[model samples]
Target: MSTVHHLDPEQGSLGSQGSVDLPVDCGQARLLELGYKQELTRRLGPMTSFSLSLSAMCFFSFFGGLPTAYVYGGPVAAVWGWVAASLANILVGLSMAEIASSYPVAGGPYFWCLELTRNNKKYTLIAWITGWLNVLGQFATTGTLGYITVKHLGVMWMLANGHVFSNAETFLAYAICLLLAGLVSSVPAKRIQQFAVFSAITLVFGGIIIMILLPLCAPKLQPATWVFSSFFAWEKEEQGIPTDAWLFLLGMLASQLVFIGFESPSQFAEETRKADRTVPKAILWSIIACGILGGALVLVLLFCIQDRDNLLTGEAQGYAAAQIFYDVFKGRFGNGAGGIVLLAIPLLSFFNATVISMGTNARMLWSFSRDRGVPLYKVWVVVSKRTATPLNATWAMTALAFFLGLPILFSPSTFLAMGSISFAGLYISYTVPIALRMVMGKSFPQGPFKLGMPQPVINVGAIIYMIVSVIVMLLPTQLPVDSNNMNYTCVTVGAVMILVMGAWYLPYWGAKNWYIPKRHLQPADLPKPPARTLRAKHGGASNGASPSGSRAASVKTMPSTGSLPRVPSLDSQASPPYPSVRHPLHRSTSDDGSEMSVYQPRLQLPDIWKQPTPPRLQRREEPERLPVLREAPGKGPMVPPHD
Candidate 1:
């Protein structure tokens, strides 16, 4: 039971005014309804949230993957494939926005799963699976970003020198990239906001610069018939594929990478001000904006292709776009200038993407740790006292990225395999909660943001798209796969699922106490307050008080009531007005026959306010004196302590 205070008009007016001045109360009230406190600072606005999502998507950086699309389905596949993927991703974002609006927690999809299946016996198990998969997917994303940065740097190095380095040198470069990303991520949040803004500026203006330069500087552009009508051509015939259709379908997977990280804004929901409204807009706008920008960039690159045969023959060291840039700009601007400009965009874009990925991974890990869903929760959940950021979780994610990227030293194909796993894990995690919400129909809680009548259709469409994405991601990219190049996505995803379920069900692991969400006790569910007996103010043997004629403090009792009072609005300025219940102070007589009051610490409010009385007090005899009254050197009399 809680105590409620009655306020006069002035006090009530202050409360009402405050509620209007700062609307965080509304967000907090929604969180309380979902059984959580506002643990993270709400400092991010809509632009900051959108910037982070755009940086995560990093569409310009993913131009490296365009070669794969071109190889499988020719120029037409690269264009149409991105359009189709963007449409599907928009549907996914909308469905997620509806759910995010209702439960805007840092746990994001996992928290949604918990709330959606609140009454089910298996809610904990489902939530656990969703969380782990999300973590793994984030780790894979970080690793992939690190790997891309290293590979792009290596290409720049090759342009500088004439030879390729050994596997050891490549590993060192990857480690350096991961280290740099971690350092950038550990900066203060204020700096991170600045970095996010800079990233957005660079993405927009930098993409425009490249698009303009590529067309103007090229000696001769590809014909429109070839660029737009070459849909049925298969550029890669050495893979020993049985049919063109299978190869083209495999090529479509590259489009999936363009919009992979659109869900990043949802991960920062706890930190964003007005999250219910901001997050959905951020998610939708980032995807649509990236889709438009990315599609335009692809068309510009395809039109500027000078020699398709040279690019397809691995002339760019698996980054055909780099070869196109070198060919176009080297003639007009010189090799040194062209190489620097060409490499700078991806390098900067990858670095930006890496920092955003690290931040997202740390937030997700911290949220899971707060719920006791991971090992070593005590260490992982520690927020820095100075910055209020999860420093420990940030380093943990960096260490995991380093460990995951170690395979690049042995097999370059490992990066591709990890990318596939990331695509699969994140999409599956997304599909589950949306599917559950669809199954719940009208019973599901609709948040402030809704898809209205087309919600069910959108939800079902998103699920089917995700299912196809997962299947496509797990398939081998090339025919006649060998040990080194075989896709390990299936094996990696299976291992993760098995590990998560085993930990959940195993008897040795005491997960139930920590991982399960507790059922919140609302004010109405509390026990009623007991009746109190009132006696005459001057005298009563039943009421505990000092002996008659002694200097005793008067006790004021509240009128007895059956039900606990409603809790006052949190925005109210006035504290609850309960009667003061003071205990008798002990006195000791000195040798000069002067009495001194013994010091006693005041009691604090109990956990449950509506209880009949406070808990039994334990008396202490310490000599740490608290002054009841003090007499100044020239004051008339001793003054009592001010309230």
Candidate 2:
């Protein structure tokens, strides 16, 4: 029905690339309608969105989790537990994706909370809490990834010398990683985009290389009976879990940890092209694809488990998963060098995850500060003019992550500790806005992406899945819950929420009175785009020409009763005003000259309004020619000359 768009300055014979005019960024106007102007560049192409999200989802994390899954529930738990976790996260991803597509803002869940709560000034409490949760969750994720990177680095040290790192060494290694990720994240988003592509390829191909080559190159594979049904039993009495059923539930952590960061894509939405459509696809599909790939990866690692009895006893320098990769290549190739080299693939992928996670978290922090939700809002809200990245926020989160890992020097079980809260914080934050939307009746303005009839069902399912996951994440993996082995999810996330509440009610400076970002949250009252009024610019003017028409046509001045000579219209002359802009201020002369208005002008709209500044007033040479007389009602806005 509509094919008359894209004005051209050149002919087709000169170019097959088509229109030479600069293309409009897809969601810029929509963002203006959302209240805040676009502060970030829409530089991320389609490939970067998907890859960046996948990298955050951590496809390479399967190798790291393999050891834990095998120790508790063996091959069966490692393979199928991941499959079950994938299905659960996919539901959550879909629900979040629908909302992400609708909003496509950088604040992600917290901004959504503000809107779904009806955007009133008092209701910003929901957004405040949600933003704090997301930031804490992201910090936890960065810590977890840092430990994993050190673990991978430990694998290299183990292959060369023979033992895992001491607590001090682990801290030192993680510090190096923190500094590196912070430095990388400080670069412009454009360069970080290239790293995303590399990381995604490494993760997908790294899994493929291991799954295909390790199995074929191994001396032998574990039987189907063992791979599908076996359970490597730990000391059930010591742990007090008492049954394989409970242990399998415990092993679900292996997969759920890898699935938690799919929301990263939505954090990058403001910087992505056609964000309304692209971000939702990135959020949803990144999980579905990563889950399937990770399941295959864990399945392959299970079949290649050559030493079941000694695997738990740190036979391969205390890294149980690295032992499987070493034995496979050592059996066939007479050296573990190939295995070590290949293992670096996933390790580097985790490094990429670290950088990207820091980047997304900075964006969320910047957005939260923009709404005055965080302390020193002015400091964090500043974006770098040179790189256009949130450098201040990036460095702040990176420094805080260094502290989160400091606990590792005191506690041995850094993985189980940070892992618990990482998943819990993200899952709980994700649940809030989805629940608020459901309470609002789920009937809002649809964006480029919407679930239609299935939306409500998916929303409910995501909420349930997240709530259950939060509970599971809080459960202690070990029985004798002490300082070292306890699941600190409750303590860490609970303390964070209390601090958030303190900021909320802190007298005059609190967010309670000031947080009002989602002013247009209620769908019924959301601002609509203004209708176009000028329509005489197209054929009347060529390229680089001013719009044609009586810019004074709509001037609000005193009207006269006489009919003026008919003027030429752009429409009759095959001219149409540019659809994207309003009429500008100018004066036009007719064949039979007469003033646009008899008396002086009364009101003038400003140019900033697009509004097209009001037509200029004319001053007579003698200063007596113009009159101040008012015209009668129901008359055309023109005057007859008194010659």
Candidate 3:
């Protein structure tokens, strides 16, 4: 049996009121690992496999890409917009791979900034900015999706039979959908993953069917004078600028919008098994696959549609693509079946967006709360012990998203306002971490996942994309001179949000109290200490004399007699083998109050920071559990300890 060791409290350093000794069994060494004990069971299986991965890509891509293309660019620019977006996603994938690999945790960039800067003041401020912005950014994105789903569904209902619900129909639909999505998200994480797997599979099959059969069914696919052309080849207003250059740039902006949410996997990295390797791969795989497949689908549809006039006007409608799809499949499968299949894509797209939105927003909220940035820290951050999910955070984001989306439902004109402003806010949030990384230079640590390519290349690419994305996201879709049609939606709303975040920071979440980097690894995970046997020096216990040796005495076990005798008068060499110096009035007590002379253990200052043995492997040993958050009531001023 292994013997357990502990500090001798009597010989240890003393505090003002009490002596300090290393804990023999405080139960804290494994706290980090066991803290999530309840939440671990909620994780999904590891073998998500390639099919599911591809399906996930399709779901996210369709939700993110299709809406942007159909609404702003129409068919021509939409097709080319996908191409630009694909290339941009590659850059995004590379950057994220580095960051995700380095910090494979749930909090995403917020956590990354904290670790990279090691709680430096400037970096702490940046992290604070990133955390709140990212959280709010995700909510805004969810709101945008809510807005789009309601608008599209309402329009479809209106066009079908003119018995559309009412002017308030979209708002009511959005509210219902948001609430329902929240409910789906509130289910345990394990269950949500199971659903995700099913939705992902359906999403992929739907995409393949629509893309493959729809274009083939279009009438006059190879019509005379309907040859393929670049996005810029078609001119709408014949503005002074060169069409190709302007359209290409504009298309780049549109495509970037589609690729904005690709980092959803990284946000949930902690929940992912073997995330150190898988999270980065997931981000890369999804981005590459989506870019390629989505771009191709857009290209095919663009080339097949020759009547640009009808495509742009309300005549083509957004569902014109769906019609093209039905046309191709109906000739062979029968009109009724084909029409249903064509409609399934949009229906699936709507649900896909909802699921993705719920999952991403929930993770963001969980991340923020876990870091203590948000209010209701305990409840919001608490992962269901059974499901390993932050259900409270999910529900909260859903409620907020529904509230934000209420405006769009009441006034169709405000849809663009809500969406564009949300987009701007999200991008601004994204830019915070990226900009700080660039400016912070060499101060940041290299994370587990890194952009293997040269630093200059990666940074330049990111900056370029950021500039373009911000420019496009800020521009208003329309300028109708009404309050609802206010231009530069992103800029207007984003400015207000930033100001609000800044204002909040001053009162409660300031620079000093903003970031506190707790040790993340449990004792079992920490490196082990080297072995050594401490030896006493001259004039020490082993030398048969203490520094003030006067025949140091004991009441119980005495020094061995092999090398010396207790009394000099009785033997020629009469010195104790081991001695303990004692005061004249010393009355050392042993266990059971029997007196003994034994030199108690003392720790070196260098050993103070050494990792302790974990409770799991400690046999009978255990440590005390500390409160997760240690704060006071009322609005007393907050300050970080000097350590």
Best of the candidates, lDDT: 1
TM-score (C-alpha, index-matched) for candidate 2: 0.78
Q: lDDT of each prediction vs. the true structure?
A: 0.72, 0.71, 0.54
Residue-by-residue lDDT tens digits, candidate 3, 1-643:
1111223432221121232222111111111221211123314433342222443334333433443454443454575566666776677567666666656666677766765565576556667776777776677777776665665565445445445566576678878878877877777766667776776666667667766765666554644233234334333243223444454555455566556566676666655654556667777777776677677666666555634445434322445554344344444455424544466565656656666666777887777675567767768876666666777788888888877776664665565565664555556655555565666566654544566447557766866777677776555444334455445465557676677556556666554454453433332322222123232223434334324754233222223212111111211211111111111122344333435423332322234344556455577845897545545679565565555
Ranking the candidates on TM-score from highest down gives: 2, 1, 3
For model 2, what is the alpha-carbon lDDT of residue 169?
91
| Best of the candidates, TM-score | 2
Q: Which stretches of candidate 2 lie over 4 Å from their true place?
A: 1-23, 232-235, 242-244, 414-419, 479-485, 507-509, 518-643
Encode model 1's per-residue lDDT on 1-643: one tens digit a residue: 1111212222111112223111223343355456554456566778989999998988865566777787778887777787888899999999998998877777778778887886365667888888889988987888888777777877777766756767778889888888988888887767777888888878878888888878989888999888776875544467666676667666777778767777777888877766777888899999999889988888888998877878756446767778788778766666645745666976888889988999899988988887778999779878776666788999999999888877777876765676566788888889989988987889887777899999999998999989988887777766779876677998788888888888887786646545665433344422233233222243444334434644333233445434332333423222222222132123544333445432221224344554454333445457987776656688756866579
Residue pairs with colliding backbones in model 1 are none
Candidate 3 regions exceeding 4 Å error are: 1-76, 155-160, 222-244, 312-320, 326-337, 438-444, 476-486, 505-606, 609-643
Using all chains and alpha carbons, the TM-scores for the candidates as numbered come to 0.77, 0.78, 0.69
Cα displacement (angstroms), candidate 2, residue 42, comes to 0.6
